[model samples]
Target: MTTYTLNQENLNAISERVSTPKYNRTQLTTGIVHIGIGGFHRAHEAFYTDQLLHDTSITNWAICGVALLPHDTKIYQTLKAQDGLYTLMVKEFDGSLSKRVIGAITELLFAPEDPSKVIEKIASPEVKIVTLTITEGGYNYNEATGAFDDKNPSILYDIAHPTQPKTVFGYLTQALKLRQQKGLKGITIQSCDNIQGNGDMTKQMLLSYVKLADPALIPWIEQRVAFPNSMVDRITPATTAADIEQLKTEEGIVDAWPVVCEPFKQWVIEDQFSNGRPLWEVVGAQFVKDVEPYEKMKLSLLNAGHSVLGILGALVGYTTIDEAVNDKNIHAFLEHYLKQEVVPTLSDLENVDLEAYIASLLQRFGNVSIKDQIDRICSESSAKFPIFILPTVKANLKLSRQTELAAFVVAAWAIYSLGTNEKDEHLNIKDALKDTLHKQAELASQNHPEYFLEIESVFGNLKTSKPFVDAYVKAYKTITKEGVIIAVQNINLSQINSI
Candidate 1:
C-alpha cells in the first residue's frame, strides 16, 4: 500500500488515483497574484485559471497564491512543498466524485513571513490582475453606513504603518503607491467573495483607505485600478481529517491541503480590466458589461437561501446542509422564499433561467457527499444578513409584497444568535457583533423582537415598519412556542392553504 504524495514527481504515478494536470508546469509563468488564498479560491478561481493554462498560448496566466495571515502559514508551507499543486474533489449531486490536481498556482507566499515579497509581487507590472476572497468582514465596512469604517482598529493600525500593513486595503494602497512610483501600469483588482457589488465595494473601501492613509496616491489609484464586480459560486467545504484520509484510502494520493466542493462552479465577471486580464471567458467565465443583475440574483437567491437553511437547520438539530434540505418543510421553506419573496426583487435577465438555477441549488444543497455544514453557513450571519437577506427585505418592503418569509429568515437568525439549539447543544457564534448580538438575544428571549431588530447596523429602520414587525413577531413567537420543526411544517401548511 504505497501512498503517493501530491507533487510534480508523483503526477504521472498517480494518474489512476486522481486527475493529474496535463499542462506543463515548469513553463508556467505567474501573471496573476491572488490574495487570501483559501479553499474557495482554490476550487473556483484557481480551478478556472488552471483550465485556461491548458492552452499553450496562455501559459503566462499562472497564479502566485499569497496567504496574508499567520494562520495561513501551514497552508503556505503545504502548497509550497507540493509546488502549488493540490487535489480538488468535486462532489456531484448524483453522489459522483471528480477529483483533479489543480496546478494553476505556480508560487506560494506567506505575507507574515515576507511582506516585502508579497507587496513586490502585487506591485509588479507583470501581474495585471490582483484578486481577493478576504471574506465580508475583512473589508472593514460598516454596512449600516454603507462606507468603510476608518475607525476599525485594524484599519487604524494599517493606516499608521503603511509599509508594514496588516489588512488587504493597506497592502493594495502600498502596492499601488509602488506601482505609481515605478511608473508601472495599473492592475485590475477582482473580488471573488460573496459580497454584493464586490468590485465596487472593494473600490470604495480601497479609495477610502487611500484617502485616509495617503491622500496623494488617491488620484493615481482612481486612474489605474479597476475593481470589476463579479459573482462567484461553488460549495467548497472546509477540509477535514476524514476528507484527508478518504483521499489517501480511496485515491491513494496524500494531499496536505485538498479542496472539496460540488461539481457546479460559476464566475460571472464584469468585463472591465485596467491593464489586461486572463482570457477567463475562454474557460466558462461569463464576461458581461453588467454584473449587477447576476450578482443580485445569486446573492439574494442562493446566498440568502443558504442562510435560511442554515439558521433553521441549526435550530432543528440538523448537522449538514443535506440533512437540512432533506427535511421536507425546510426544503419547501427555501423554495417558497426564493419564488415568493426573493425573485420579485429583480427584473428578468437575458438567458438566465432562474427556475433552473433554484432547482440546481436544491440538488446542490442535498448532495450528501459534500456534507456542507449548517454551522459553516451560519458562521458569518451578522455580516451575511446585511449583504444577502436585508436587500430583499428592503426590496420587498418597497414593492409591498408579502414579507412573511423574509422576516422569518431574520427572526430565525435572532433565535439562532442565542448560542444554543433546540437540543440545548452549545452552538458556535462567529460574528463581529457577537457581544452586541448576545446582549440583544438575551433581551429578545423575553419576547422583545425590537431588541434584536433595532440593531440599526443590521436591520436599519426596518424595525419601525409595522408589516415587518408583525411578521417577525409572529414567526418568532411561533418558533419559540411550537419548536423549530413544527413551526416550519406550520408555515408550509399555511402556504398550501393560501394557494
Candidate 2:
C-alpha cells in the first residue's frame, strides 16, 4: 500500500482511483478571496471552481481561502501545507464514491496571523472578488432590529482601530479602505451562506458597519461595490475520523482536512458582480437575474428539512441524517411537513416543481455514504431557525395554516436542548444559544413554554399568539411524555393533542 500525503509533491503519485488537477497548478492565481473556509465551501464552491478550472483559459478564478477564527487555525495549517490541495470525496445516493483533488485554492491565510496581509491580498488589483461562508450567526445581525450588531465587542473594536481588526466586517472594511486609498476598484462581496438574501444581507451589514466606523467610505463603496445575492446548496458533512481512515486505506491518500459531500450540488447567483462572471454556468451554476426565489425555495425545503431531521432525529437517538430520514415514520413526517407546512410559503418561485424539489431533498438527506451528522445539522441552529424554518412557520401562521409539524420540530429543538435524549444518553448539543435555550427549556419544561419563545430575535413574537403558543406547549409536552419517535410518528400530530 503506497500512500501519498496530499500535497504538491504527491500530486503525481496519487492513486489512479483519485483525480488530480489536469491544468498547470503554476498558472492558477488567486482572484477570489473567500472567508470562512468550512467544509461546505470546499465541497461546493471550491469544487465548482476546480471543475471550471479544467478549461485552462480560466486560471484567475482560483481561491485564496481566509480563515479568520481560532478554530480555522487547523484548516489554515493543513491547506497551507498541502499547497491548497485537498481531496474531495463525492458520495452518491446508491453509496458510490468518486474522489478529486481540488486545487482551486492556491493560498490560505489565517487572519489572526496578520490581518494586514489579508487586506493587502484583497486590495491587490488582480483580486476582484471577496466571498464569505460566515454562517448566519457570523453576520453579527440583530434580527429584532434588523441591523448589524453595532455594540458587538469585535465590531466596536474594528470601529475604534480600523487598521487592526477582529471580525470579517472589520477585515472587509479595512481591505476596502486600503483599496480605496490606492485607487483600486471595489471587489464584489458575495456571500454564499445559507441566509435567504445572503448577498443583500452582506451589503446591508457592511453598509451599516461603514456608517458607524467609516462613514466617508460609504459614498465610495456605494458606487464601486457589488453584493450579489446567491443561493448555494450541497450536503457536505464535516470530515470524520472514519473518512480520513477510509481515504487513507482505500485510495492511498493521507489528507489532513479532506472534504466529503453528496454528489448533488447547486449554485444560483444574481449575475451581479464588479468582476466579470467566472463562467461558472459552464460547470452547472445558474447565473440568473434573481436568486431570491431559489434562495427561498432551497432554504425552506432543504435547509428546513435538515433541521426537522436534525432536531427530531437527535431526540430519537439517531446520530446521522441518513439514519433519521431513512426511518419510515420520520421520513413520512418530513414529507408531510414539506408538502403541508413548508410548500405554501414559496410563492415567489416560478417554473420550479416544488414536489420534485421536496423529493430530491429526501434523497439528499438520506445519502448514507455522506453520513451527514445530526449534530452538524443542529449546530448553529439558533442562527438557522431565523433563516431557514421560521419564515415558513411564520408565513403559515399568518395564513392560519396547519403548523403542527413545524411546531413539533421546534418543540423537539426545545427538548433536544436539554442535553439528554429519551434513552438518558448525553446529547452533544452544539449551539451558541445552548446555555440560554437550556435555561429557557427548563422553564418551558416546568410549565411555562412561552419562556422559551421569549427570545424575540430567534422565535420572534410567536409567544404572543395563543394558537402557536398552545401548539408549541402541547407538542413540547408530548415529546416529554411520549418520546420523540412517538411524537413524529403522529403525522397528523394527534399525539401532540394527547397532552
Candidate 3:
C-alpha cells in the first residue's frame, strides 16, 4: 500500500519506473506566461516545452501558468504542492504508455487569489511569449460579429479595476500598461485554440476590449503585442479518477493532477512572435509563414471529425469517441463527411495532403487508448459548431457540394441537444445554451421542423436557404422516424446512389 507523492523530491524515485525531467528544475526561469492552463495545455504545449528543456540547454522558456477562474483553484493548489511538477502520461494507439514528469511549468499563480501578482508576472521583462488554451467559449467574443463582448460582467469589472482584473483582456491591458510605462520590449500573444484565424480573432477581441477599457492603451497594445495564430492538435482527455488510479497502481506515482493524452501531437505557429519564442521547431513544432491553411485544415478535419463522431456517437448510445467511430454506420458517415463535405471547403494548403490528413484523423479518432469522451467533444458545441462543422455545411451548400453528411451532422446535433436518445433515455449534455437549444430542438423535432434553425445566432439564416432547409428537414425527419443508425445508413445509401 505504499505510494509516492509526485513532487520535486519524488522525481528521482519515480525516474526508475517512468521518465523524469532531465533538466535542473531549480535553474528554470519564466519566459512564457500561459493563461487558462488546462488538460489540453498540459498535454500539448507544456509537453513540447518539457521536451525542449530536457533535450536542449534552454531554461528561460519555462511556463508560469495563470489560474484565473475560480475553477482553477484546485489545479493551482495541486501544481503548487508538487512544486510545479506533474506527470504526463501518453497513451499510444498501439496500447503502449509513456509517463514523464513535466518540469516546464516552473511557477503557478492563482489570479483569483492575487490579481496584481498575475498582472506583474505578465509584465515581467523576462517573459516574452504569452499563450492561451481557454477553449472556444473562453474568448468572450461575439460569435456572429467577431467582436469582444464588453458587456461581460467580469470584463466590465476588469475594466474598472485594471490592477484587480478578472478576465484575460483586463489582465492583458493592465500588464501591457506596465510594460509601456517601463518601456519594455513587445511580447507575443499566441492563441492555441481551435478557431480559424485564431490569432486574428484574438487580436480583434483584444484591441476591441482595449478600446472599451482604456482607449489610450490601444495603440500601445497594437505596437507591442504579437498575436500569432497556431494550430495545436492532441486528443487529451480530462484526467479521470480511473486514470489517477491507473497511474497509482501501475507507476506508483500519485500525482494530484496528472495529464493524459494521445502520443500524437502537432503545433503549427505563424512565426510572428514580437519578442522571441522557444526553439519549439526543433522539438516537432512548425513556425510557418501563414497558419491560416493549417488552422482551417485542423479545424475542418480533426475538430469537425470529433464532432461528427461525438454528437452522432452520443445519439447512437456510444459513450466514447472510439465506440462511435468503431460502429460500421457511424464510421461510414464520418468518412463520407470528411472527404465529401469537409474537404471541398478546404483549399490553399501548402504541402499538406488532405487524403493523408483525413486518414490520420480517422485513425486518431479511433484511438481507444485515449478514450476521449464524447461528452468532452459534445460539450459547449454551441461555441464549437459555429467554428468546426457549420462552415463545412455553408461551404458545401455554396459550391453545390454534397451536404447529405453535413445535414446528418447538424440533424444529429439537434437531436443530441434534446437530452435523450431514440430510446428516450437521458443523455449527458454540457452546453451553456443547452436549455435554450433543447427547447428549440424539441419544438423543431415535434411540429415546426424549421423552428430550430430560428436560432439565428447558431444556424444563422440557414433557415432561409432552401437547399439547406430541404436537406436538414429531410435528415431531421429521417432521424426521428428511424433511429440515428438507420438515418445515417439511409443518407449513406442515398449518397452512394447519387454518385
Residue pairs clashing in model 1 are: none
Q: Candidate 3's residue-wise lDDT over 415-444, tens digit each?
A: 888898766778888987888889998898
Local accuracy by lDDT, each model: 0.88, 0.86, 0.86
lDDT of 2 by residue, 1-499 (tens): 8888999988988836588988887987888999999899999888889989985478888899999987888889989999999999888777788888998998889999999999899999999899899888899997655778888898888888888889998998888988999998777999999888898899899999989988999988999999999999988898999989999999889998899988889999999988665889999999989888899999989998999999888888989999999998899888888887777787867789898888888988888898888988999888888888888877988989877878888888888877888788998878787888888888877877668888877887888877778888888888788888777766445533432
Tell me model 1's lDDT, rounded to 2 decimals. Answer: 0.88
Candidate 3 weakest lDDT stretch, 10 residues: 141-150
Model 1, range 1-499, lDDT digits (tens) per residue?
7899998888899887667778888887788999988999999999999888875467888999999988888989999999899999888777787889999999888988878888899888789899999999888888778878888888899888878888998888888889998999989999999998999999999989888999999888888889999999998888888888988999889998899999888899999999888888888999999999998999998898788888999998998898999999899989988988888887758898889989988988888999987888998788899999989988888878889988887787888899999999988877879888988988998969768897887777888899999999999998889988888888988877776
Task: Supply candidate 2's per-residue lDDT for 64.
Answer: 93
lDDT of model number 2: 0.86
Worst 10 residues of 1 by lDDT: 51-60
